[model samples]
Target: MKLKFFGAAREVGRSCILVEGKSTRILLDAGVKVGEEEAEVPTIPNSMLQSIDAVIITHAHLDHCGYLPHLYSNGFNGPVYALKPTLEIANVMVNDYLKLSNPRDVNKDWQKKMQRKEKTVEYHQEFRVKDLALKLVPAGHILGSSMVEVRLGNERILYTGDINLKTTRLLEPAYTEYLKADTLITESTYGGDKDTWPPEKDVLSGLMKSIKTTLDNEGKVIVPSFAVGRAQEVLFILDDYMRSGTIPKVPIFVDGMIGKVNRIYRHNVIFCKDELQKRILMSEDDPFKSSNFVMIEGKADRSKVLKHQGAAIIVTTSGMLKGGPVIKYLERMGSDSLNKLLLVGYQAVGTPGRELQDGAKEITLDGKKIKMGIKVETFHLSAHADRPQLLRLAGRIQGLKNIFIVHGEERKMMELAAALGKHYKVTVPVLDAEYTT
Candidate 1:
């Protein structure tokens, strides 16, 4: 067996890896980075790529599965395997990726070509295509997130796409027991010396406090969140707090992809915790359709939402404050001292959200200085594991001979690499690096 670091090596964007063994070549997660206008993808020899029997996607996150559409355009023909929800959302997500990347009449044909070649795999069900055996275990990150395990020619390999050990309010924890894999490839998104996460309660308390302060001042609170995992988690938290009377009920407006995504969440509620699904199916119970939430849609509808009076909570997308409705919300609410901006996800470098996290008073967004006298707070209610949690996850895997850390900042990966070096013998490979086993 052989492993090669293609993408998500020494960086946290595109996630792709190659496994060659048992007369089969498996390409795990051929994704594209969302940061740059142009991205770099690792290329395989035509001989090797043509022989690839399967393509496995771990989740629906763009960084982990965004580049899949490009693969269909690349002349590689093979079954694309992912969980049911992952497949559904991937179909939804990839179209959005193409539209956002190349939004023109000319690119419409390109999008159709990619969507034609796709397949779905249900959880716990194993399937064989050509020389590869594939199965998916829950990754506990999003609605259809999963950890992939493949068996080939008497060798077993596990690739955790993007895992979260701790279950959020909406999802279950990652399935940790492999029982058989000799080689385990794990995500180190928070793998580092400084990757410390606050406890869940404390994080929630801080989030509520931030919003409460804005509400108290009769100011608006703008929360820039990912429309999927983080947005749902925040909604669930706010819902519970509101029901408990911890926070006063106020007009809550959700913008960007959130409204459409909430429908996806409802349509596939079974993929979540059993009780959440029951809450939806049961009469006189609807957690997502609270009285306070106003799902903002279209430019005209969003403009009406911004003009609302009194205290309100605006949850918008482009989680990093890079673009989307959050920018519009910021342009309006930023200068007000009464308004508050809460960051509920990891802000990438050079992103507006990161600047706010770093206490930058002025930011360039939509060609203007988004000057703010408003308060800004950050909470790490992340979908990735922290340092101790990452180490604990590492402890759970059986007989790990080699560990390759991917999908993290260089320093964080190096920190994890250094820490792992203390107790276990593992190799933290480099960008475009290759090794044989």
Candidate 2:
């Protein structure tokens, strides 16, 4: 088998990988990197597009599935396999990406065609596409996220796509028992030796404390979050804390695409953790429909929300503060030192959020430099596995001989490779690099 890296080889976005067996060629993911200036797609050649027999999507995150519509537009009409919820969520993510970034490349006709090619597969359900036997296991990163296992000829390959080994409030841990693979392809998003995560309880406590301080001072709290997994997780934390009297009751405004994705999450509770499923199905206390959480309908409602008298929590999208309604809220409420901006996910370099995190007092937004005094705080509520968790996961796969690390910065990838080099033949492939195994 041969593996090729088109993107996300030593970076954190545009994750595309091609696997070529003796008789079949499969694309693992076709994604785009949402950058400061423009989006970046994979580096696949035009001649290779028609040779791909099928595409397997590991999750719905834009970094893992955003470029799929472009594939259809480029005349690749192979079957796309994923969990049902991943497809539903990817529909929302890809449409939003088109409106923001590559509007001219995709049309309604291409979208319909892509949807017609979708093939939903359940966890552990074995399926065959041409010469490859495949199965998906839960990846615990988000709802419907999975790791792909492929068997061809006499070799087995396991691809870990944005995995989280530790369980959180929403999902179970990644499945890693009785799995055998000769080559392991994994992500190294947090693979540095110093990238250990704090305990979950402590992280939650710190986040609540920050919010409580702002609320006590009668200031609204603006939480810039990703629309899919991080937004939903933050909402649940706030609701659960409010119900337990850990924090005072306050209006949690849901903006951007978060409210729509929340409904998709609620509808697919079967993919969530056992406790989350029980809370949704076994009672009237659905966290997704919390009374304290209100949806901002339109511009009129957003204006009304900004004019409210008391303290509130606004959870909006464009997590990196590159775009979306979060910017509007920041413009209006940012000067107030009492108000707070809580970042709940990874902020990419060159983003406005990263600037704030790096202690920048002035930022340029849409060709305008704005001065701000809002209190900015970051809580490490990440969904990716840390260094220890990654090592633990690698230690579990039976018959693993080679490891390929992708989806991280160069330094962190090297650190992880050094750690894993003692046990296995680890290779950190560069962009467009190909290797045979």
Candidate 3:
């Protein structure tokens, strides 16, 4: 078998890997970089583009499955496999991408092309297509995230597409069984030596304390979160704490794509953790259906929300404040000294979130310069495994000959390679690099 790294080799976006067996070719996780004007896609050979058998998606994150519709525009017409929930979420995301990326006249044709090529697969069930035997295990990153195992000619390859080994409020930790493999493809998103995460308990306590301070001042708290996993986790945390009287009960406004995503989460309870599934089945109380949550139905609702007298909590997207309703909320609340902005995830370079975290006094948004007056705070609520966790995962994969590290910055990947070089041969692949195993 031969493996090729087409994208996301030395960088953290556009993840595409090609696996070539004796008789079949599979493309793993065709995706695009976030926040870029033009997409960075994988380079496929002309001979193999029309004959590729399958495209396996590990999750619905844009960096993992965003570029799938672009394939249909080309000559390739084959099955695209993912978990059922992934397809559902991707249905919403891919359509939204089309609206944003294309003009009104040409968007419909692109949307129809993606719909005809999508396929669904069951988790943990072994299936075969041509010369490849495939199975998907829970990756524990998002609602339908998975880790894929491919078998060909007596050799097994395990690909971890953005895995998280630690538990979050919404899902269980990543599956950690010692799946033996000849080669392991892993993510190095948080593989640097200084990437140790703070304890979850402390992080939560600090977050509640910040909210309490804002509420005490009769000011609103703006939480700019990713509309998917981060939003759901924050909602569950707030609801759980308020119900237990551990924190003040306040109205939480769910905005952006999060409201629609909540419905998807409710519909797919089977994929969640056992505790969450039991809460849905064994109890009458639904955790996602909190009375305190108020949905922002349209842009007209924004004025009413901002004019409210009492304290409130507003959760909205784009997590990095690059776009979406979070900017509107920031424009309204950022100049108030009593209000607070709580950041709950990694802020990529050049985003407004990173600027605020770095103590920028002012930022330009929507052609207007806004001064920063709200209290800015950060917490480690990432979905990726840190250094020790990454090493532990590498240690657990019984026998491994080659380990290819991707999905990280250049220095971080090298740091991970240095840490894992003691026992196994670790290679940090560049874009379009190919290797035989």
Candidate 4:
């Protein structure tokens, strides 16, 4: 068997991997690179990509599945295997991704890149092509994320798209059956940090304290969250705080694509924690209908948020504080000492969000330099596991053979490789690197 990393080998954005064996060749994921630096769109070597057989998507996040359309446009005819929800969410997220990006770059290359799209499959479902048998399992990272196990010839290889071992407010714990594998390809988004998160209670308390301090001074709290997992979690945390009177109930403005995605969340409540799903099916415990989330509607109405009576909470998208409505909110509310910006997700290098978190006093936003005077506080609410949790996850799998770590920075990937090498044979591949076993 041979493994080739076309992308996401050195950094956390685009994730593309190739496996060839047992009369089958498959692309693990064709994700896109993101962040501030002007970057070239990623594609596989023309030599290997021209006649690809199939693609198995791990999740619907842009980074995991965003490059599908580009792949199809580049001349690859293959079925994309993913969970049902991954398929559904991918449709929404990818189309939105294309629509939201620059339309001005309509050259032949750009046109071809966006010309074709992806097909979706479901979980536990099996797909066979030639001699390959692929099974998708719940990954528990988002609504439709998955881990995949593929059997070809006599080899059993497992690819974790992106996994979360611990259950969150919205997702179940990752599937446990694939604890045995001959070859395992895993992600190392948090491989450098070992500290497990503090108790949820402590996190909640800290969030409340920050919000309270801002409210006392009558400042708005602007949170630029990823429209999917992070947004939902933040909203739930705030909802719990307000319902229990742990903090004052402020008008929380819901902007960006998160509002639409919330509907998708409610529609797919079955994928969430069973307890939460049961509550949704049973009583008046509708978390999405809280009075705090004043959905901002119409483009003209955005200015009215500043007209609100008291301190407000605004949740918008483009998580890394990169773009979207968060930019507008930051431009309007960022200079106030009364306001605060809480970063809750992984901000890649060179992103404005990362710059802010790194304590840049002023940043250029939407073509203008804004003095950042807001109280900025970072909380440990990442969807990815920390370094220790991931190491623990790696240790639990039995019969694990070759471990390939991807989806991290150069430093982080090396750190995880070193840590996991004490026991397992850890291989850290460089961009476009290939390994045979």
TM-score for each predicted model, relative to the true structure = 0.94, 0.98, 0.95, 0.93
* Best prediction by lDDT: 2
- Candidate 1 per-residue lDDT, tens place, 24-75, comes to 7778998777753544455544456566777888988888777776665555
Q: For residues 1-437, could you state the per-residue lDDT of candidate 3 as single tens digits?
A: 88998788888877889998889989889887766354556666545668888899999887788777777666567889999899888778777766666522235565577677777888789888798999998888999999998999689888999889998877998888857787889999899989999888998998898888899888899999987788999999888888888778888998888988889988998888989989889988898888978989887887788777889999998889877888888888899989999998778767789999999979877668999999899988888888899888888876778899999988998999999898889899877778887
Which digits, one per residue and each the tens of the lDDT, describe model 2 over residues 416-435? 99999999999999888789
- How big is the positional error of residue 118 in model 3, measured in Å on the Cα after superposition? 2.3
Give the least accurate 10-residue stretch of model 1, judged by summed lDDT: 103-112
Which runs in model 2 stand beyond 4 Å of their true positions?
Answer: none
Candidate 3 residues lying further than 4 Å off, grouped into runs, are 45-48, 103-106
True-vs-predicted CA distance for residue 279, candidate 2, Å: 1.9
Instruction: Give the Cα error of residue 279 in candidate 1, in Å.
Output: 2.4
Pick out the ten consecutive residues of candidate 2 with the lowest summed lDDT: 102-111
- The top-ranked prediction according to TM-score is 2
* Model 1: lDDT to the true structure: 0.79
Q: Give the Å error, residue 259, model 3.
A: 1.1
lDDT score of model 3?
0.85
Looking at model 3, the pairs that clash are none
What Cα-based lDDT does every candidate model obtain? 0.79, 0.90, 0.85, 0.79
Clash pairs, candidate 1, are: none
Error of 4 at 90 (Å): 1.6
